[model samples]
Target: MNEDKNRIVSHGAFVVRYRAAGAYRFEAHSHPYLTVTSVMSGMLEAEIGSSHLVAAPEESLFTNSFQSHSGNGSDLEFVSVGITAEAVAEAAINAGFTKAGADIAFNNSYSSDRSVAEIARAIAAEVLSEEPGRNAMLDALISQLVIVLLRSHLRVKRSPLIELSRAGPVDRRLRRAMEFMHDNYSRDLGIEEIAQAAYLSEYHFARLFRRVTGVTPHAYLANLRLEQARELLINTGESISDIAGAVGYQSQSHFTKAFKAVTGLTPKSYREGTTRAVEPAEAGKAGLESSNKVSSGE
Candidate 1:
């Protein structure tokens, strides 16, 4: 048995728990074996091949052997277990199955099956527990997990792939660019500045940023800033121009236009609609006086 800060490992099965704030992201990667990822709280967004989906609490995701997947999430907490194909392959080799294909593969990328989710969560909990003899307990649970995966997750209905393709992690340059935006969304930013932060040429960085996020850096930053603007609008009595400048927009007119474009309502209307009981003037401030903020000062 092996243990780490938030993980446990033994023959055939290894489990790990993840709990974090902000956003949790990983460039594209895959396990050398089959994996079951379960959401315990918040949400998990993943991309498997061409499919994009979100897993909520008590929901689970399954992946085939060597299946390529990438994802990111905010305020996420989840647990995952990987069933090692190398271990099984070694055992098969020792048993003289050098020519036999004894490793298993799963078909589905996502599962809401209560039984599977329950089992995955239980395994997660067991690995994270400090109780006695957990190594032995894990052995028993993993045996059962194999049965469950075979019974429910492994699909025989569809033709199986002969080999799954592997993709490299999201470029480090892109990660740097993303972090830059998160830190500097309130400042006037340009593609040239963001690309320089990533240490890449403007044209190269632009293409890769769009390829990874499906949006140009400008659009991405705009969306992020707008999201922050929405939060400020709902949670505080910051003036429209204050909120606009705080999130990188130089002009109130442009901010209003862009905010309305993404949120389907003008900033004033959104603030009013969200805080229905409050006076419209109090709900939508047009002044920059922090001491006169309605949400807190009143």
Candidate 2:
């Protein structure tokens, strides 16, 4: 097996475990691998890009690769199932799934109370168990999990590509601009360069892009950079200055200021917060609250 495959706890394309003590905080980060998270026990507040999601016990969150996000848990134990984007796309094509054109952004709420939760629990248990044919078992479980999630997505009439296409002409153009920004975010991206990618005049593109995405192209790019920096901070022991440079910020102070503005917490504080545990009382309360959130939404 390849080293990347070996790194996985499962036989499928992507899967791993993150077990941390107390309330865990993750700085903004993006992964090349798609991720599906299941909260075994605990409460977590996650920000996927600019949107916020609250995860309770048995709930799941699916994020596409390179989707900027961050999370923090107070008194919780969780397991995240990582699937490669290539694997998901291949599976969809093989299954002949069509785009549904709805934005199926990940919700903190459970998709289905009985069935989806049951499947999540079963997969979690099997993954944690040491038994015969564990690899095969994991592969089967991942397949089942993907099916359940696809069903949930279909029920909501949401397909990623379809949703992207539905963003209207202006939004589509903005998405293209975002693509360009992502590709060259570490380098100096002139407004004219981004505008050309979307086939619009710089003034027109700048106005429309902000109208659609709620931030100037520069601000949006900065947000993406900070998100990348946050990920390195949490996942690696890289020094702050190195991370700053990697994400295109020459001044550590500038990066720190932007990171705090977007995340509401300084990077150092966020990292330290991850080391503290969530109080038992608060965990119980969050569990109850999440249950209510799911049922009420239905």
Tell me, by lDDT, which candidate is best. Answer: 1
lDDT of each: 0.60, 0.57
State in Å the error of residue 72, model 2.
Answer: 4.2
Per-prediction count of colliding residue pairs?
0, 4
* Number of backbone clashes in candidate 1: 0
- Candidate 2's C-alpha runs over 4 A off are 1-17, 26-35, 46-54, 61-72, 82-86, 99-115, 118-140, 154-176, 190-192, 202-243, 251-298
lDDT tens readout by residue for model 1, 106-199? 6778889888777777766665565655545555676566666666666422212112111112234465776777789888788999999889
Candidate 1, which ten residues in sequence have the lowest lDDT sum?
Answer: 289-298
lDDT, residue 57, model 1: 86
Q: What is the per-residue lDDT of model 2 for residues 224-273, given as tens digits with 9 covering 90 to 100?
A: 68756755665566877788888998888887776775544566654542
